[model samples]
Target: MIERKKYMSLLEKWRDKKVIKVVTGVRRCGKSSLLRMFREKLSDNGVEERQILEFNFEDLSNEPFLDYHVLYSHIRKNLCGDRMNYIFFDEIQMVENFQKVVDSLFLLDNVDLYVTGSNAYLLSGEIATLLTGRYVEIKLFPFSFAEYIEALPDGTPHDTAYRHFSEKGGFPYTVQIANDDEMLREYLTGLYNTIVLKDVVARRKITDVMMLESIVRFLADNIGNLSVIKRISDAMTSQGRKVSVHTVENYISALSDSYIFYPVYRYDAKGKQLLKTGQKYYLVDTGLRNIINGTKGGDLGHILENIVFLELARRGGEIYVGKVDNAEIDFIVIKGEAREYYQISLSVRDENTMQRELAPLQAIQDYYPKYLLTLDNDPVVLHNGIKQMYVIDWLLQN
Candidate 1:
């Protein structure tokens, strides 16, 4: 494991707190691995092995707990009398009525609960209501470029790693096994199908699996584009597939719930208003996008933008697609009272491209750190206020 210091720090913050620690992310984005790492940390901290009750619903041995009663009883029976029990439930959402079990265990003073799930639905409607303000959700994403570089061979150049990262993506398992592209693609495809079929379609009782897949693929292929439900509906109709605008929106919601694609709302920072019309969708992993669309030739800029979006999200910022006047900023990340603007481009070499990339940040008229991240080696010195840096270098820095 290439130690994720950021998430580890979050774990330290909520280590023994009363609130439940919920880890959520896309399927195979290393949520389970993060739980395992934390469990090891607990052991290293002298937490007794017996006091930890680890249950993975994905494993066949735990299938009996699919029923809420059995799950509750099993947990209740496993509780230690004197010591505080640390319960680590991996993919807890797989069990029906899991909120009841979580709520019940949370009521006990002797238990510190940590749960992992692949989708946002793990904290959806009822679950959110049940654990309202009583839980802290720590989102996990695939490897950032820094983590990606750390996983690569020692002799690999920064450019090589960046290219591979752009092409293969930052999915942890995929990054680890670099030899077999075929196997990696297959695994990503299967994971995507499982998330769509089991988590979204099956769990939500969605009737149109084919339409859902089509909409998902369209979104994946068109990352960073302003997407409107009506446009999506019309496009699908033109392709000889019938789907209502509302149905398309519902499918998009399902995808978001499953953590497959994250839609970024446009925030007009200057105007101080949130726009409701158009939004951008970013894939959890570019590798999965490649799998869905078959490694295409163009759209490298959008892929890079998606990577940066997820990275900012992993850093625990509330991200928005920033719109200032007619110019657009790729992301505006706000944490507490601090905010930063970012623009992502594959290259700012061309004069027009440089102006286009810097225009949004220049228009902001604020002292906040504004950056333009690119793959170019040449240092750009345009726009007195905006900072220009290589994306990989930026990722390596704090």
Candidate 2:
């Protein structure tokens, strides 16, 4: 397994702390793997096996312990000594009213708890009220380009590695079948269906499964395009499927809550405020997008943009699409007092394309590292202090 140092470092910091460590992401994004890796680390560090109690609710063996009382009793009965007992629960959302069990276990003096879930419901709604400020969320993603490269066999050429990484995406399972296109596609399709059927449709009790699929396809086809619920409703109605704007809104929320698609709101760069109407949605992983929407040659620009969007999020930046005057910037990332502007494209090889990509950043008067990233081969153009970089180089470096 690739060492997910970023997430492991976070878990190490929160080790034995009073707060619950809540790991969240979409299905099969490697939450359980990370927890298992952390368990191995703890054992290597002299923590005894008996001191750690781990349960995955998805496992058939754990079905008997799904009841809150049974789970609580199991943990309570297994307390080995006065030393801290680390409890790792995978897919805690599978258990109904799990917050009560967690709340009850939290009262124990010897327990240091960690839980993983596929949806935000574990932290929002009623659970939020129950665990108010008592949990720290560690959001996990499939794999960063850096981590993806590390997972591959040693000494693979960077170009070949990058092509495979972008095409196959960072899902760990995909790495196992990277060389087999048909097998990888089948795996991704099955994974996508599970997320839709189990995470969104079944969980929300959405009756219109066809409508949900339509909305997902629309978002995948129009990645990074400004979207509104009414517009989506109208589009679906035109296709002989009538869906209310309200229903569209609810479905969109459900998709986002499942971590299938992320919504990035527009920000007025000059006004320093978020614009509500022209919000854009990006997929959590481009591999799923490509599989669901059918791989298209024309969508490379959007694919690169999606990759950059996920990279920004993984780097802990608060990202927004920027509108500066009549021009739009692809990304405006604000992390702490550091702000960076980015415009992503397939290439700025042509004169008109170069100016179009640079216009928005040139219009901005700030000096906070504006970048125009593309696929150009190191043709450095330093226009008014804005640095133009090759996208692959930037991804590998940062």
Candidate 3:
């Protein structure tokens, strides 16, 4: 396994802090692997094996301990009273009344807690209210392009790795199985079904599974386009689907909670008005998108945009789709006092396409860093002070 230095750095900083360390993301995105990596870190640092308590709720051996009370008793019985104890819970949300068990654990003086969950509902109103101000959330994503490169053989060129990254996506397991596309496709399909059935449909108690799948397919089909609940509802109705706007909205929310799709809101930087409607949805991973909708050439721009958006999000940027006047800038990412505007495209070979990609950033008055990222190796940087970068170069950079 390639050591995830970015996430491991976060774990090192938060090690042994009183705050509850919560790791969350879509399933098969390496949450379980991260926990195991951190556990190894603890042992390497001389933490006694007996002093550490670990439970994976997904494991069949722990089925009888599904009750919160039983889980609590098991932990209490294993505690070393004379020393500080570390508790690691994998997929803790599967247990009944888990928030109560977490709250009880928080009251203990000798325990430091870390928990992982695939669904956002795990930390929804109930857990948020119960453990308010006492926990720190650390989000995990699939392999970034940089990590993907690290996992490749020494002779592999950067461009080849990028093609695999775009085609196979950054899922750790998928990257490990690079030689077999069939196995990769099967794995992605199974993961997609598990998330849809277990995380969203079953958890949300939605009776219309077909409608939910239809909406997901529609969103997956159109990643970069502006979309709204009403538009989807009307289209489905026209197609004889007979779903309500409210139901569509509810289903979308459940999908977001499941971490399958992320909606990016529009921010009008020049006008300084936040638009409440018509946001773009980006899938959590491109591999899943390719699996659901066969890998096609027309949507490459949107897929690149989706990958860039997730990369920015993983780096702790507050990302928004920028709408300045009539033109649209691909992303507006802000961190601390620094901000960046980006325009993503597959290629800027045409004069009109080049002008169109550069126009939006030129319209913005701020002198903040502006960039045009594309797949073209010899992109010409225009006079508008925007930096033109190869997407692969940008992906490999810090």
Candidate 4:
């Protein structure tokens, strides 16, 4: 496995810290592999095997230990009192009342704990209230463009690599099956279905599978477009799905909780406040979008915007869609008190497109750095003050 250096670095930094390291992400985004990699790191750094305890509740063999009492007893009995003990739990939500196990384990001064879960259910209810600030959540994602480049065979052209990456997406397993179109489609389809069925459907106890799927398809098709729950509900109803606004909100919430889609709220750049309505959602991975929409998903501009959103997310910041007066800035990334504005487009080679994209960024006063990213192959240029860059080059940047 290509080491997930970004997340690995986080795990390494938090090693032996008092807080429980909770790794969360969408299924198939490699949370389990990341934990395993960190396990190796610990061993290589002189942590003895006897001092580490790793449990993956998803395995059938672990069924015997599914009871929190049995699992806690087994782990507690294995603790090495002479030295620090490292405990890693994969899919901790699979165990009944796992929060109690985590709380009990946290009380033990001898162990440094880590856990991974596919959805937000792992941290809600009793666990959220009990743990409070005792845990540090490290959210994970599929490969960044830099990692995507590293995963490809040595010496592939950058343009070719990015094209394939954009089409097939960054799921680690894709590195192995990308050459086989049929296999790639089947894998993504199965994974998407599993996420919807296991995480979204099962957790929410949702009955309308067809409506749930329709919602997924709608979100996949409308990435980067500003939408509200009522609009989505009305559209689906008109199409005969007949879902209530409350039901649509619940379904979308479950999807977000599963890490399959992210809803970015709109910020009033002029008023410096978050708006109550008009926000957008972007899928976790473009490959899943491709699988769900099939050949009908053609708008490359929105797809490119979707890619940039994921990239910004990996870089770590609060991202929002910015509306300054009537103009819409593609993204506003705020880190602490500072903010960076961005506009994404397929190309601004046409003067009209260039002006349309530039108008929003220019409207914002107080320079926090603005950029216009496009797929066009060109040297970096400045439009007034906004930096115009080749989107591929931007994605490959550290």
Candidate 5:
């Protein structure tokens, strides 16, 4: 297994601090596996098995502990006096009033707590309010391009590995079946359905399942394009399926909360403000997008853009679809005082196409770094002071 060094380093930095470590991500993104791996790390570092207590609320046998009192009592009994204790709760959202248990345990001086949840709701509850400034969040994503490459067969060429990664996406389960296209499609489809039905519809008490599916289709069909609720509603209406704008808004929020789709707002780079209208939505994984909507075959342009967007996000960039005057930059990444602008395309082979991609970055007056990423094997060179990079090369560099 490839070690998730990025997340592990974050956990190590905050190890044994006076804060709860909350790990959250979409379902099947390996939250449970990460907690297990960390637990093993603890054991290897001389932490006794008895000092570390782990609970997976998803197991039916753990149902009795879903009550806060029961959970609190169980862990309190397990506490051997004196030494620090590590507590891990997987899918803690299954527990009723779970925040109470966490908040209560946190009062103890000898306890270090960790939890994994499937949605943002876990962090927005009364527990978050109580623990304000006392917790750190580690948002996890599916395998990245670098992680994906680690699983490739020995001696696979870079282009072949990239095509597989781009086509099958970076989900761990999909990687196991990377060579089998048919099975990967079926697996992703099942995973997507479970996320929608269990995570979104069931949790949100949504009654219009069909409408939700329609919206999912619409969003997947138009990834990385400017969108709004009214536009979504109108598109559904034109297709003979009527949906209200308010309903569309709620559905979109549900999708976002479930971590299946990510919404990127448009930023007015020239004005230095976020634009209120015309946002873009990208899926959590391109393979899932391909299974649901055949996005990979139809528009490699947007697929490349979506891949770049997720990579930027994985590197912890404050990302936005950038708008400068009449020109649009694919992404604007701001980290502290440093800003980087990116324009992504299939290739910058044509002079006109390169000029089009370069115009927006050139229009910006700031001296922040600018890049134009593409699939061409063009030598890395400066065109009008903007750096050009091969997208695959840039992804692996992270």
Candidate 6:
């Protein structure tokens, strides 16, 4: 397994703290592996075997513990009261009323807990009421470009690795079958079906699986385009599906809750507030996009933007599509009191393209650091106040 350094740093930082550590992401994004890896790290770092316990609710043998009371009892029996007991629970959402178990364990004076969930519901709505503000969340993503390159075989060309990362995306399992296109497709298709079945359809209790899949395809095909519920409903109805706006909105919400799609709203830089419309969705993994939209030539610029969007999300910030006057900036990232603007393009070698990409950044009046990232392999340049650098170089940089 590739070591997720950034996430590991987060886990290590929160280790042995009083608060519960919740690791969340889409399935196969390595949440379970992260917890297990950290468990090993604890043991290696002098934590006794008796002080640590790990359970994966997905395992059939652990079926009996699906009852919150039984699981709580089982964990209590393993506790070493004399020392801090380290506990790891994988896919805690699989247990019904699992938060009860979490609540009971958290009351103990000598316990440090870590839990992983595949669904966002683990931290939202009524489900998270029991542990609200008592736990810290670590949002994990698929392997990043830097981590992807580490997983590649020795001597793989940098450009070739970048192409593979762009095409297949950062799903950790994709690395094992990177050479086999046929097998990779089969894996992604099955994985997509599982996500819809377990996370979306079953969780939401929806009967129209086909309609939900269609919505997913639409979102995948238009990753960086505006996602209007009414427009989507009308488009489906035009094709004779006859769906309501309410239904479209519900389906999109389910997809977002399942961590399959992320919606980014537009930010008015001039007004310094989020706009009510013109939001866009980006997929969790591009490989899943290939399953919906066939593996063919795609909009390279949008793909780059999607990759950059996810990277920014991983960097810890409130991200928004920037709306400055009439021009649109690719991203407006605000971390604490600092704000950074980004414009992603496939290539800006053409003078017209360069000017167009620079326009949005130049329109911004403040000096909080504006960047123009492109695929053009040239020395970092500055267009007035905006810094132009290669996107690949930016992704690889520490």
Give the alpha carbon lDDT tens digit for every residue of 11-101 in model 4.
Answer: 9999888899999999989999999989998999999999999888888988978899999999888999999999999998888899888
Return whichever of 1 and 5 wins on lDDT.
5
The parts of candidate 3 lying over 4 Å away from their true place are: 379-382
Among all candidates shown, the one with the greatest lDDT: 4
Q: Whole-model Cα lDDT per candidate?
A: 0.87, 0.90, 0.89, 0.91, 0.88, 0.89
- Per-residue lDDT of model 1, residues 119-147, tens digit only: 78789887799899899998888888888
Residue-level lDDT of model 5, residues 146-193, one tens digit each, is: 888887777887778877777788888888887788898889989999
List model 6 lDDT by residue over 274-385, tens digit each. Answer: 8998799999987788888898786978888998998898888999999989989989999899999999998888999988989888888898999999888899998887
Question: Could you tell me the TM-score of candidate 3?
Answer: 0.97
For candidate 6, give the lDDT: 0.89
Off by over 4 Å in 5: none
Better of 1 and 4 by TM-score: 4
lDDT of 3 by residue, 1-398 (tens): 98899999988898878889999999989988988988898899999999888888889999977898999998889899988898989898899899888889888889999999999988898679888888999999999999988989887898888878888888899977778989889999999999999999999998999999999989999898998889999989999988889999999999999999999999997986678879999999988888878877567888899989988888887888999998898999878787899999998889899889999999999889999999998755655689988888888888
Clashing pairs in 6: none
Preferred candidate (TM-score higher): 1 or 3? 3
In angstroms, the error of model 3 at 198 is 0.6
CA deviation > 4 Å runs, candidate 6: none
**lDDT, residue 176, candidate 1:** 63
TM-score of each: 0.96, 0.96, 0.97, 0.98, 0.97, 0.98
